[model samples]
Target chain A: GDKVKQSPSALSLQEGTNSALRCNFSIAATTVQWFLQNPRGSLINLFYLVPGTKENGRLKSAFDSKESYSTLHIRDAQLEDSGTYFCAAEDSNYQLIWGSGTKLIIKP
Target chain B: GGIITQTPKFLIGQEGQKLTLKCQQNFNHDTMYWYRQDSGKGLRLIYYSITENDLQKGDLSEGYDASREKKSSFSLTVTSAQKNEMAVFLCASSIRTGAGQNTLYFGAGTRLSVL
Candidate 1:
């Protein structure tokens, strides 16, 4: 079984629309981190959570360690938001287990 | 306000050739990591160093080697390149806080091609 799994492997949305990405952890997760790998291939850190929800601008993320899952919601999506989103979970050993990723395309 | 720099943004090597990728971080982070990303796949940890002169093997460290002689730099070496191998190597750094993990800052990445 996958230690970390991401759903909706690919998503397409219109600008100004909304969408959500999810990650399921089979291992015991203590913390979660979300990152966006842009078209240029540079990864940008989006949110880091510890069993709670966090919001930054149009992006919001929540981590439910007890349930072993996390969610990233994008509100009012923009073209620049088009990229691959990755979620990583920190296990008890403090090692990060990564998800395959979700490829997002926001069309204008 | 710091940046992680990976040298030789691109690399091409022949089969069985030994190639090295270098990373430097100005963040002065205590922990640095090397991850390999395959097309449409997730990042796999290769090696990580929690401090200078220390190394920890990740799940995918089998065919690779890593060095961290200085606090500001960490490097990964491919012992022997495989023919038709292609992947992106990413370097990241983060400060360890208390007993948990912190946010990570990654470099642009080094794309490798083996012929």
Candidate 2:
């Protein structure tokens, strides 16, 4: 079963544009985390949230545990932002489930 | 400001052959994990350790063996490689916040292919 489902499996953005990626959880998530997998295959943590929202430079992430959903917003997309974005949900039982991921391609 | 090092960035093995992957972390964290990522799919946990000698099996632990002999190092062994199997194995470590909540620091990943 897919506990964590991500939308827009693939996305393309022009330079200087914006986009949003989403993840919906079927289970009760107590915390959420977002990561970016770069071309070098390194998984970098972008945001770790308990609830509410957080903004890090051009990237902003929001998690609503009550609604069982989370979102990541990218502002002024740059070529360096071209990578795969993933969101993972953590339940009270300590189970961490991941979404399939959204592959974002930033074009020139 | 520490990094996770995964040895043999790329691995090639024959069917039915035993293979091993190694990971080393310098963050002195208390928790470590192993995950497998297939093409177009999310990562699946294979193993995790809470401390130097505690090992826990994950959802995808079949056909895999793990060891946490030392606090800074963890190793995974493939019981028997399956033909045509290809996947990327990621190693990560984290400082326990509470219960199981953590922000992971990952290695560059080990790309494996079976012949």
Best by lDDT: 1
Candidate 2, pairs of clashing residues? none
**Candidate 1's residue-wise lDDT over B7-70, tens digit each?**
9899999999999999999998999999999988889999999999999999999999999989
Interface RMSD of each: 1.1, 1.2
| Candidate 2 residue runs with Cα over 4 Å from true position | B98-101
What value does the TM-score of chain B take for model 1?
Answer: 0.96
lDDT tens readout by residue for model 2, B91-113: 99988666645888999989999
- lDDT for A50 in candidate 1 is 91
TM-score per prediction, in order, is 0.98, 0.97
Error of 1 at A11 (Å): 0.6
Query: Among these predicted structures, which one has the highest TM-score?
Result: 1
The CA lDDT at B79 in model 2 is: 96
In candidate 1, stretches whose alpha carbon ends up further than 4 angstroms from where it belongs are: B98-101
CAPRI quality of model 1 = high
